[model samples]
Target: MTGSGHISAFSARRAALFALLSGAFLACLALLVSPPPVPEMKSSAIPPPLRADRQVEPSFVHHFGRKHDEATWFKSDFYYPNSGHPAWQADLIHFKKNRVELEVRRRKVAYKNIAGAEYQRRGFYHYGRYEVVMRAAPGSGTVSAMFTHTHGQFGDPHDEIDIEFLGKDLTKMHANYFTNGREHGGIYIPLGFDASKEVHLYAFEWEPGAIRWYVDDRLVHTATPADMAIPQAPGRLMVHLWSGTRDQFNWHGEPTFRNGARARFYCLSYQAAGDDTEQCSDSYTPRKYRR
Candidate 1:
């Protein structure tokens, strides 16, 4: 081959080698100049749905006696002291310990069917979680219930939430909540404490969208808004304790017919709706607390 031909071949080989080296150098630069490897990011986990709020410790909000100026009222409308047909004319007796005791008898009495039924025009209802501490009477054919619910008294679309203790076994507490007059809730939890035997704290917190029932310090049941429409807006707040009934609970497998059974003693504590929010965050000790 001519000298010029030889030079041209060598030039082509050099050009190819230079291109290969440039590519290799670029790869090396990428390995050194790029950002350090990002360790795989770990994500936190979340809780499940339809669960009650966590169990909170015992607390007491201010509870004052009847105030004439205040429109809110919490008076026991019916008291039956003896074993006669239930009527609305029984008297409430005062105890030496400054606690009020009412005689709830087991007798026949006609009650309004409205879930909106009101007591003294003051709508009585409870939507937040509530815990009732009391000792109940023992025996079969006897049904006792403490209600913290919404009734039709104020308006339509009524709701009701109940915590009941039947005869003989106060250790087992039942919880039920209603929405628009339908049975949308149910739970059976061990109080770990007794009802007829001794006095223990029984509570259920009905939050904005859930309900958590408690006994003393133990969390018995947790309910969700999907089950019932609780913490309803503009609903009444009520606290009721009765030993007998002809209501829906009986037909639905509840032990009804409380005969002369008495709710020995009871007290309710709750937070009042503060000025800033429509919810309450206080405790109520009977005749002992003030807002």
Candidate 2:
């Protein structure tokens, strides 16, 4: 009887150990499959908002037909070495066949250097409605973005509003805003359709009190000052297509460069605050807002 009791106790101990190990293994698997956590806004990270006075009668529209107006648009010819990824090359930007093509090509070089393209409008824009009609690139590790950015120009704090598509999942649109180099709001809106498969209208209206993001003219998300201080610094409208590094695989999946990637921009427009009419219009119909 003593020996039998000891055997039963030993079996129970072994069973408990197995249960613990199984639970831990499942937890690790869940983490590996789950999406990365969206960063929370911290008050300590917020910077004092800059003053953005409404510009008077600021408006412009560009339809990418043959060539971008050199007087108003600048194709970036610069690269960031410290970014440890792709370098912006003017040759990768193409204006042909009625659209602006931002291409990303893998390079046979040391340290993962790739070629990418970026186009930025000259000068800065204040509070306004910004719109872009474009198709995102499709490939793991690539990012197709349309955003307003002021990278601390002239000593102003870094402020930005972003609309980004992670090539790993073109069905999800990522929206984020940064103030003084600190990220405040980050979200993923599940687009009902693949953004890379077709051209769609994406827009954001930035005001003093709120920033509203729209997909096909349907309001998808709204960020108020209560969530975080609204971005105030004037920023230049820009678009780029670039790839992520290996270390960023968790956020953007590993890149496969067999065929390369390209993002197409059909049109871009901006309407300054208090403007009554859009600078240009497209044939796309507005969809009803959905949460």
Candidate 3:
């Protein structure tokens, strides 16, 4: 071969090799910056809650107003059913073998006001770790949630943090938060397993400026105040087993329960602002908390 031809071929090969190396380097850099995927572990461990002092005071005053009868009202594990559903009672909430079962069966007498069962904790939790080991019920139109929420009269801003499971699909779950009545952050996380088939620990770390979500102790998602609105008010933790219509904002789908649906809670644990951890129960005196 001529010398010029040999030199031209050698230069072309070197350029091609440089281009390949550059492309590989860029790809590796991108992977390093991207968030890690949800880990596939045989079993994920639930992390303990943070024991830190609260940095901010609660935004709203907690007043235990007009109390209900002693047998049914403000129990730590009991929440009064609102939204036009009043049939919920302590009977529907059962604790056995350290598991809480929030069951909704076909009521023999379908009162116009009774639709489902919901339970909210008595006191409020400000900033800490909220955790639950649960298996969502299986049925469309039904939603199972372990959330913290608070609301005011019409036109007032509200605050909430949620970990919700739609019976429509057990392989996925959704988390959302709101501040001052405006919906801010939301994400759909694939559980990588059937959530109704077994109990899985789901948790969220709540703090002054940030919130993080975890599934079986895996850090799946996180958000900061700059990215989303953070709830400032001290709010009650709640669990719900309710069916919604196609129109509600938190709608899962059309309500359908041939025999009825149920949710099982293996445990609900909370580490509150002062590093106080407690098992949820239904027992509270509203007057004591009244501002």
TM-score of every candidate relative to the true structure: 0.54, 0.75, 0.62
Tens-digit lDDT track of model 1 for 1-291: 999999999999999999999999999999998855533312211111111332222223322233321243434334323322134322332232422333445433344211111122133333444445455656543445656544343234556667777664566777887777777744766766666667666666666678777765567677786665664543444333343334544522343434344554345555332322221123323333211
lDDT score of residue 20 within candidate 3: 99
Residues 38-151, candidate 3, lDDT per residue (tens digit)? 333122121111222323322221212233324222323222323433344456665554455676655532232234556555445678887776778777666789898767
Model 2 per-residue lDDT tens digits across residues 113-232: 677888887677878888988889888888899998876433567889999998778899999998778787559999999998878899999998899999988899999888888988
lDDT of 2: 0.77
| Residue-level lDDT for 216 in candidate 1 | 57
Which ten-residue region of model 3 has the weakest summed lDDT? 41-50
Flag regions of model 2 displaced more than 4 Å: 1-57, 108-112, 279-282, 285-291
Q: TM-score-based ranking, best first?
A: 2, 3, 1
